[model samples]
Target: MTKKICWAAAIYPILGLLGGLYYRELTKAEHFAGDTQLSIVHTRLLALGTLVFLIVLVLDKVFTLSATRSFAPFFWVYHAGMLVHGTLTVLGRESGAAIAGIRKPADAKA
Candidate 1:
């Protein structure tokens, strides 16, 4: 449980950073002048994803929450939600690309 929580804490911040980069580059490439859903995705991942796991880690340390039978299922379900959100964000980009021609960050010129 400690290991799992630590991994989530580490992975989420990375995802948040990538989401931030994705938002910036994709918007710039598309010449999008208005606010975008992608713009807030990073903050969401950082705030919700990282923070929740940290709190869960501390609680597990104190309460041994993982000793309970339900903990495993709950953990998987919770992480699944985060993955689904990330997947949806990427899907949004793909659909938006079809309409407005979004470019990849790597393909953008320096």
Candidate 2:
């Protein structure tokens, strides 16, 4: 579905930008001068979500990818996966923030 692919490409950049803004503002508000999983969320969504769909769009033009039955399932599953991953990344950034007091990814290694 060209419409579906176009929508995915269009929507993901918005989501990515929102993620970037959220990470920056939240970290500043908390005075969190440290590495965070949130830092990667924006890029990950841009690349895996938007960029991947754009690739699919190009391929669709040449190969009529939407004619296949698998396209619908793939479109839905891929979006869901990216959405869940972004959500979890955001959630995990604050994990253990309460009891352990700011356990960053780097802090866990030592």
Candidate 3:
């Protein structure tokens, strides 16, 4: 169970890295207007996802939380919430851009 928690915690940094790369690409694009929503996605994925996961791992070690069944549910729900939040944020940004007649670079392919 501890190993499972560690593996789950490790996934966040990789996801955050992917988010950072996407944000970096957007920043480098000439026509991509800087959007706070994208930045929020990057920040929350790193800060809330990666950083908080590590913190939780440390707390679990100190408190011996892996022995408890509640930890599994709590862990899954917390990560799910982060995923949902990030997805909704990106969708909201795209929706807002669409409403304002701003075309996302990715939408150009369609």
Candidate 4:
């Protein structure tokens, strides 16, 4: 189904982002601290993310479908969303402190 394929292509990035966050945390922990391994995760995420992007792009043509006006294509909406989310996930998991800096100010501080 064209719609299903579209949905899948779109979902991949979101999942990838979650995966990034998990990867980030896993790599940043004291027990798992290792640039080599961290790099590997980063590389994998980018590779997979890019693949997902390509899939969404190409699948549109291959499947001969269009997203509903009400539900815009995931590829378009999630392009940056997924990239940022995934990157942040990886970074946060690996370096929570870095992510903490980006979060909203603590209530006490605010």
Q: If scored against the real structure, what TM-score would every candidate get?
A: 0.54, 0.56, 0.51, 0.35
lDDT against true structure, model 1: 0.69
Candidate 2 clash pair list: none
Whichever of 1 and 4 has more lDDT, that candidate is 1
Per-residue lDDT of model 1, residues 20-72, tens digit only? 88777866666666534556768877888899889989999999998999989
Better structure of 1 and 3 per lDDT: 1
Query: Candidate 4 versus the native: TM-score?
Result: 0.35
**Which residue runs does candidate 2 get wrong by more than 4 Å?**
21-39, 82-110
For candidate 4, write residues 34-105 as lDDT tens digits.
333333344444566557655755756776445546335553553344344445444444324433345442
lDDT for model 3, please: 0.61
Give the whole-model CA lDDT for all candidates, comma-separated. 0.69, 0.71, 0.61, 0.50
Candidate 3 — which residues are off by over 4 angstroms? 20-39, 89-110
- Residues 5-75, candidate 2: write the lDDT tens digits: 99999998998898789778876667666555567768877877898999999999999999999988998
Using lDDT as the measure, which candidate wins? 2
Off by over 4 Å in 4: 35-110
Q: After superposing candidate 1, which stretches have Cα over 4 Å from the reference? A: 23-38, 79-110
Question: Best candidate per TM-score, number?
Answer: 2
Residue pair clashes in candidate 1: none
Model 2's alpha-carbon lDDT is 0.71
